[model samples]
Target: MSLLEHLEELRRRLIHSVIYLVVGFFVAYGFHEKIYQLMQAPITFALKKHNLPTQLVIHNPVDGFNMYLKISFMVGCIVAAPLILYQVWLFISPGLYKNEKRYVMPFMVATITLFLSGAFFGYRWVFPGSLDFLFAYSHEFRPLIEVNEYTDLFLTVILGLGISFELPILVLFLSLFGIVSPKFLWKNIKFAILIVFIIAAIITPTPDPLTMCVFAAPLLFLYLLSIGVSFMVHPARRKRLKEAA
Candidate 1:
């Protein structure tokens, strides 16, 4: 393609992405109050469980309104994610082979599923555990919590989970490219587990083992799953072993 063609394609995709995000933003903003309430549940629950009278307080005067905007924008991005993915696929799809194209639908579905699942896991399981742990530790002291600080923690965990859930896709991409192999991964399983804990330790804000394990376990499982996928790519290894036998 010529430079003009590439530029045209770029412009087209950008326009589509922007449209999707704007639509998402509007829809999310509409539900911003409900979303904020929903997000605050875990922290509130934890506080209640500990019998603490304190609620998250806002030091900044504008925090309450600004937080709603941030929450709405986040929701909007999620609402528009499919369109963003489609636009991304559209941009790259023209370059893919027939076999590659065949994989696109499944990949698209899997991408959304994994991302949602990760977000869900964080919200459902990890959130309460983490929130409870933190609040429980600090409850006796009764430190004033800022709304921004609480919101930031909530978003950061959800974002981390969303990113972490891309494990299968990352593995598949690496396997497709032949950069990593099943045997090589299997031989380095110890290192992989170590890496998983190291990553969990680095990424998670809380030092509680349960919180760390909650994040690390799935990542470790993904590494193992990646090895399984790598085997499918290297069937020649099986044939070679058979010939040697």
Candidate 2:
């Protein structure tokens, strides 16, 4: 395709993705209250465990409403993720061979599964543990967990992990395009470990080594998985295996 045609196609995909997100936003807005409750649950549990008040405080009157809108938007992104991924695939499909295009289903499935798994891990273990660690200090002072601030931290942990879990998928694309090979990835594994730990340190709410390890563990696993994925999808390896078959 010409450059102009490629640009037009990208525009079309963007429009479709935006429309899907808007629809998802409205749907999520309808259940925004429930979503807020779910988001607030970890903090509530932590406060209870610490024998503190379970309510999250809001200094400004509009903070509650703003949080509601933010929650809706985030949930909208989750709802629209599959459609947005599909739009992305469609945009890139023209460059792939027929056999490669057949991976669309697996790609979508793996992307969604890995993202949800990471989000769930953060919500179930990392977030609650961090909240407990933070709230442990409330023994000396009254805790006033602000709604907006809490929401920001919550999203940072959850969405950050979700996006991070897409490492294998990212590597798959790089290998498919012949940008990297399994040997290169393996050779650089030490560097990848260093980078992963750095990111875990940055993102983990707690300063403890245990919490940081909990955050970094899955990311390291995903990096290893990416190496394997590269081996499978790298053009030279795939072609050699096909010829042997």
Candidate 3:
């Protein structure tokens, strides 16, 4: 395709993606109350466990509405993830070989699964642990969590981990495009470890060592996994395997 044609195709894909997101947002907004309760559960659990008041404070009347909108938007993103990924595949497929195009299903499945895994990990373990540790560490102080602040923190942990878990997928694309290889990833393992820990420390809400390690450990594992992903997707490896077959 010419440069103009490619640009136009990209614009079309972006428009489709936006439409999917908007539809998902409207659908999620209908259940915003339920979504809010689900999000609030962690803080509520922490507050109750600490024997503190379970209510979140809001300085302004609009805070509650805004919080709900944020929650709905997040849910909308989750719902739209598959379609967005498909659009991504459509955008890039023309650049891929026929054999590579066959990976579309696995790519979509892996991307969604990995993202949800990361988000669930944050919700199920990291976020609650951080909240518990924070409240316990500040046991003497009267705690008043604001609605918008809490919502921001909640989304940060959830979305940050979700995006971070796409490490393997990122590596897959880089390998498939001949940009990186398994050997390079393996050789640079030390640097990857350092970068992973740095990202973990930055994203981890709590300043605790344990929480940081919890965040770093999976990322390190994923980096190792991404090396294997690189090996599998790297053009040379794929070409060699096909010739052998």
lDDT of each: 0.81, 0.93, 0.93
The backbone clash count of each candidate, in order, is: 1, 0, 0
lDDT for position 88 in model 2? 93
Question: RMSDs, each prediction?
Answer: 4.0, 1.2, 1.1
Collision count of model 3? 0
Among all windows of 10 consecutive residues in model 1, the one with the lowest summed lDDT is: 233-242
Off by over 4 Å in 1: 178-189, 230-245
Q: Could you estimate the TM-score for every candidate?
A: 0.86, 0.97, 0.97
- Compute the lDDT for candidate 1: 0.81
Q: Output the TM-score of candidate 1.
A: 0.86
How well is each residue in 49-74 modelled by candidate 3, as lDDT tens digits? 99999999999999899888888888
| lDDT agreement of model 2 with the native | 0.93
Candidate order (lDDT):
3, 2, 1
| lDDT tens readout by residue for model 1, 59-133 | 778999889888888889988988798887887777654545776788789889988888898889888888788
